[model samples]
Target: MVQSALWDFLRGQFTRLPYPETTFTDQVVIVTGSNVGLGFEAAKHCTRLNAAKVILAVRNLDKGNAAKRAIEEATGRRGGVVEVWPLDLSSYESVKAFAQRAMRLPRLDVLLENAGIAGPPYRLAEDNESTITVNVVSTFLLGLLLLPKLRETGQRYNNTPRLPHLVIVSSGVHYFTKLPEQSAPEGKILATLNDKATANMGDRYNVSKLLEVLFTRELAARSPLPSQAGNARGKGGVIINYLNPGLCHSELARNAGLGLKFMKFLLARSTEVGSRTLVHAASAGEETHGQYLSDCKVSRVSPLVSNDTEKHGGKLHTRIWDEIVRKLEAIQPGIMQNL
Candidate 1:
């Protein structure tokens, strides 16, 4: 397995695959953290595919506008094909505000939750660890908050035979995480993660991603969408999935040190190549709901995440989801009602 993983990692370095020829024609798409790196490339692809409105949700409007202009210049489809919206993943208020604006739109066909932080100095946001807050908490907050709009779009287009999509950006590094034992304790996981001495900040990002995968699975199971079991084409309501971009050459790791930078320079896939996975996941059908995707296909997850009929059952997955919902509810009262 180690050798196979190494081979896959090496192949990712040379991957130059183009975005698939899927047209978003008239669809409204939103990409978070789109000011630079993979998010920016993905937004560019969305415009080139003809999305009517591609919102670049970022923390800084200035950088967002610059990215929008660059994408417009590259795609040559100007005149508001791309719009900048303010979103700070570390702020609950910001997420709520962004979702409010999104609900005002007549249609929301796709939402790409691409914004994330890799490694940063220990910090807290909204009473939780910074990485967990931004990567897992606020990410889901905005996603769940926007569900109403996505569901509305699905209903409006139900007869048209299409479902709105929600795509979460995850990482294969999740497989490397051995979740903190305290992370399993009720009402204590976030607090435990916040404790700098006990928390392995190096692996905290990976743990947050593992939480994302578990959340995706639970969310799909709880979704009103019909199951993809018997039907191959998949019954549609709102399709949700997480994807691994594989060691992409992006600014996410800019702060990591010279050694890591040298390795990335030698082996990382370009942001454009990595963004193709995001575009593919966003355009995929319901069959991919709750699955981890790599290289544009439904890929196997780590044994730690694999579903088993007996051993431990689904308790671990459920525990993580319950904790997440509890934390989110504390941030926004009655937020569970939205889900």
Candidate 2:
């Protein structure tokens, strides 16, 4: 296992994957956390590919404007090709408000749930661990909230040949997480994670990513699109997938200590390179739906993630999904109705 990890790390550091050349002409795309780092680079790539509108969903309006200006200047695509939208993932209200505003868009072709945090000290937001709340709960809330719009876009252009994409930014670190044991009872897993005494801050982010993987798989399984005549399964109405950017140099680790900083400097890929994986995943075909992508391909995930049949009977994924929906419903009443 250690050797496998080392090989993955080395491949991420040295692999020169090509940036995707998928065109986004006339497409409207939204990338969260777009003010800097991987998000910013992805937004830039979208503009260069000629996306009609690229919404920079960010926490800070000032920084968002700066990023917009920089992208416009770099791509020479002015006249509001890139718009700045405020989005604070830590707050449920903020996410709701942003989703409401997004409903006004003429079309939303791609929704990239890219904003996330890491390595901060243990903190609670809205009665849940900060990482869990932002990365898993709020991220899905926003994704669920936007699903109607994505589905609408697909239906509106069903004959025009289009596939609306929802891409979640996950990490390879999820492979390291082991969620609560199956014998620990049904709802205790989330409770254990929320408990301050038992929760491990260092591992919380990894666990959050694990939740994302499970959530994506369960969501795909439960929400398959209607099949055509004589076909076993139809194309997914909204293609949702998760990807790992592979230890990129970014602001995600700014709060970490010196040891992490030095290690990052030595092993991390540039944000530009890492963002390519995001673009590629966003542009990929239905074969990638509900899959965990790495190094710009559909790679093998960890056994813990892949082996749901072990001991727990295959219900682990369903139980976790139910818990997430319950928690999300508490925050955004009737939100699941949209999904």
Candidate 3:
């Protein structure tokens, strides 16, 4: 966690992730925020690999349709193998609606939670800060809502070569963030983030990534990843994992300071190159369950989330998980059953 920022950035720039070649033939996949950047590129990859249906879940239908057309033309495959669907993570109702629609899918093989935002000027979405609401809360809301579907797909597709995956697009920025907001009083972690007086926009994105890492680990712990032996006893089936795509050439940092923009131009990978890891993580097998990935390989996390220690001091891990579960349960009663 104490590595030089310059060294880390330079390393990420030079070490490339190989383009994923995994075939997703006939699999149903969803990539949220697929209208542009990494999400768009990842969805394109899925289409190229022959996924039966690639759902482009976006906030804007126009952009989503445009992306769908572009992908269809690029792949020279038509007839709706790639479909656009409305998914505005900023609203709870929108996320719920999206989940309801997904439930009708014959099967869902992968869900890449790629939508997120950085904050500077304050804004609220639903019951929390816009970044927290969209990035952490709604992201998980959709995931939790569709957990039963993912589990069901595992059983339904048991004979197939495909595996179910729920991959979240987290970031290595989490390693640099201390997540000071977490120091707030018990049960006030998210409340403190919503407090404009206490909210630190300077590091909101990083903090959100840290939360994603924490939440993914906790969920995997509670539900347990499907085992390689098969979903025996229904103990494990879907592979739930998160990854750090590193600094990529994308619009995700559009709100950052000018200096940061210059740094990104010099240090970031291409949008296509960065998204390779997304495809890789999605197709990776049982070993990746609850693990953090970087550059297409399992990687280390900051000590705050390091698995070497049980629960990273125990209390911080459990307290944060408790707070999130409470909020999620409030949003969707009996939601934990899906996990």
Candidate 4:
């Protein structure tokens, strides 16, 4: 652990991180669902950081284009190649199509898998999985499809070493729930200390995040072994990691209804504030690779996800690896079959 004084000093330095000296200029960053909310804030920051091209990978092109214009106007800069591409995570074809398009880019610097939906009532994705479907399975599929390109960025810029990063935007709720190996009943199964009924939305969101955390650890562990001994090693192997942006009042939560949105608006931080953790995770120096960060700093995770009590404290590293792999194969048979 960093000493308290040193930690404070580091944080102070981070506040100035967005200045002219070390932004992501000349880099291509693809942020999913970047039309609004936290995604929009992230894209905005990328431009401020001088990212060469920030693609707003949104589900709706119209809204995304508007956001691109708004970001450009706000930043007082134009012609930086900020644009939008359609992406619907619930569909495998959409993810694959997006991946194929991304492959055409000369370099893919940061892939922010930030698009997600909070399951309001019980719902199923096009794949017939629960609403956690978008948060977990769909995002997983997108990342899997884009993994090769993400890794290629590292090699494409090997001389300067502008490595690629995949940031899985998770949530603080991940610590509150277990990953559902089998689907659980939807809606309000638990209660908070105040006697308020916990909504099923919380359950679905939290469980999905847990699965994401496990998947990141597993993907990083397994991807490197398949490279041929003599070929340019690590060419298609990426540093996959998870990030919890904490609670933020973004457009994603407005669909929960005005009351819910209002409550979040009162308690949640600004989108730029929320975007800080993700930006750090996406572009911090080499030491932060594969690190799980919360707030604006990397911190310890919950015991259920990172710790195993019965095995003399060895990490539960492989506890959910096989299960997720099995599910991924079933979800996207052709895309994941070989892996």
Candidate 5:
């Protein structure tokens, strides 16, 4: 079969375009699941630019270390500045520990909540929450936990003029799903059921992705407000932006089973091809804030996502935030204060 013209165009552009230059030099980037796939590729770009530090936050310590070594070698840096921190996005306790430890370090310049699980059969987290918790809630906790450090980075450099950026690597899947109007039920009730009960994996994943976008927009609105008011002298804007990296052949699909594997073999882009959107969002200038990016350009997201209609997009945002706060509070009474 002949490939679609759009695919051909994207393929050509993806191949000939040079990798984006080091826009994040001397910056600190924390990439969850940076040991492999698009996260690893993004981390490479950070090191190439001489980032002050790149933290490979992953659940697998060995894999994280190996990726760090590869980055250091490829960049030809004399010393290994990239280090690994163990983190599991599925459990609230694990998320708490990871965030608390990161808080003690110097302020972070960027937090890439890139780790995610896709299309796994229904599995319960330690807290018995749904896979959405792993994909969405845990990420929220991690980002919120790092807020103070991210803010401090902004505050310390507010005079210098560069804003700290947080990039959320979400998927286009959210175009088709909707968030719960209320809390996520109890325990793993939502997680234990297959997509049939909570829609399909595609729907669940899409809902999670939309949640990320809402969180980013809301966070961005609140963050810059205080600083803009001049209440804090050293305040800096914590810009949150979201991007969809398109399908790539990576462990992200390892559990998608045989059909997905075969499809990916034919249609999926390489990890490098998929990382462009992410790299751009992470390094783009101030003009790119709060935009949904794809194909290395700022483009309109699906109407279902950007829409503000109560029946569609608008209500979902409020609902997601409410659920997020509810879950976070359940996990820890006053965690939102740090955020």
Candidate 6:
């Protein structure tokens, strides 16, 4: 595992990820965390590709508007709309409000969940550590809340040659973390993570990414979409997948140490390069459903997920999903029913 991940990382440093060639012609897309970094570049690409409506779901309206102008000027987008809406993933109320507003949109064709934090010191938001709350809990909650809209858009645009996309920007860093919290009692994984005394801050981001991969796997198994890999793009249901943008020159590692800083200097891909992977996954075929993407293609997930002997992935995936579902249900009654 170590040798292979090292090889991929070393190769990825010099490898230029393919920029997206797929156009969004008349699609309506929402990109979270679009105010900067990978989200900013991904949103720009969507606008450049001619998405009919590109909403920058951000925490700060001013920065989002600024990014909107930057994208408009950069792309010279003629008639497509680019607007900003507030979304702070730290709070369930904020995510719920954002999802509520999204459901009212004329049609949601793509939901690019590109916002996440890494390497921050432990802190509580909504009674959990900030990273777990924002990265795993609120992230999935927002996706779950908006599932109906994505399904609705899929049916509404049945004749169109596109499927509604739910793209979560996960990380290959998940390969290094085996989710030690899996040892926690089945229903208490998040709760255990929230207890700072037992938390390992250095591994928080990686563990959160692992949770994202697990939950996406669980969601795909339970969604109305075909679980088989060969379902065509516009044939079945919403396309949900997680992505790894590689080590990138982005804001994700703002709090890392000097060793990582030096590694990033030699190994990080440009955010522009990394963001294209997000755009590529957004336009990908239905085969990507419940899959992990890297460098613009379907890639292997960590063996902890894939080497399961049990049906429906493994026990860890379902255990984490159940804990997350319970948490989400506590936050908002009946969120899982949206499926």
| Candidate 5 per-residue lDDT over residues 1-339, each given as its tens digit | 023424533463444334777567668888888899999988888777778788888988988888988888888864657888999887788888988888787768888878988774656675533667777778877888787788788878776436677788887655555444234554432343333456455456666677677766666555563445567645666767788787687788676768868767877778877776677777775555666766676656555556653456565555556757777777878868865
Pairs of residues at least 3 apart in sequence or in different chains that clash in candidate 2: none
lDDT at 287, model 3: 81
**Residue clash pairs of candidate 1:** none
lDDT tens readout by residue for model 1, 73-130: 9999998789999999988999999999999998999999999997858888887889
TM-score of every model? Answer: 0.93, 0.94, 0.95, 0.79, 0.84, 0.95
Query: How many residue pairs clash per model?
Result: 0, 0, 2, 1, 3, 0
**Local distance difference test, per candidate?**
0.85, 0.85, 0.87, 0.68, 0.71, 0.86
Better of 1 and 3 by TM-score: 3
Candidate 2 residue-wise lDDT at 154: 75
TM-score of candidate 6 relative to the true fold? 0.95
lDDT of 4 by residue, 1-339 (tens): 225433543343334223223478778999998998888988888888888899999888899999999999988768757988999988867887888899898888899989988745665566444554577767888887777677677766654444578889987666766544333233211111112243345566666677677677667555542142245544544556677776677766655767757656556666777777777778765444556776556665666755543453433445445545555676667656323
Candidate order (TM-score): 3, 6, 2, 1, 5, 4
The list of candidate 3 runs beyond 4 A from truth reads: 4-6, 228-236, 311-313
Candidate 1: Cα lDDT at 335: 77
Candidate 6 lDDT over 201-248, as tens digits, reads 999999999899989988977774643545654443888998988888
> lDDT value for candidate 1?
0.85
- Candidate 5 stretches with Cα past 4 Å from truth are 1-18, 128-130, 159-161, 178-199, 225-234, 257-259, 309-313
In candidate 6, how many Å is residue 266 off?
Answer: 1.1
| Model 1 Cα shift for residue 196 (angstroms) | 2.1
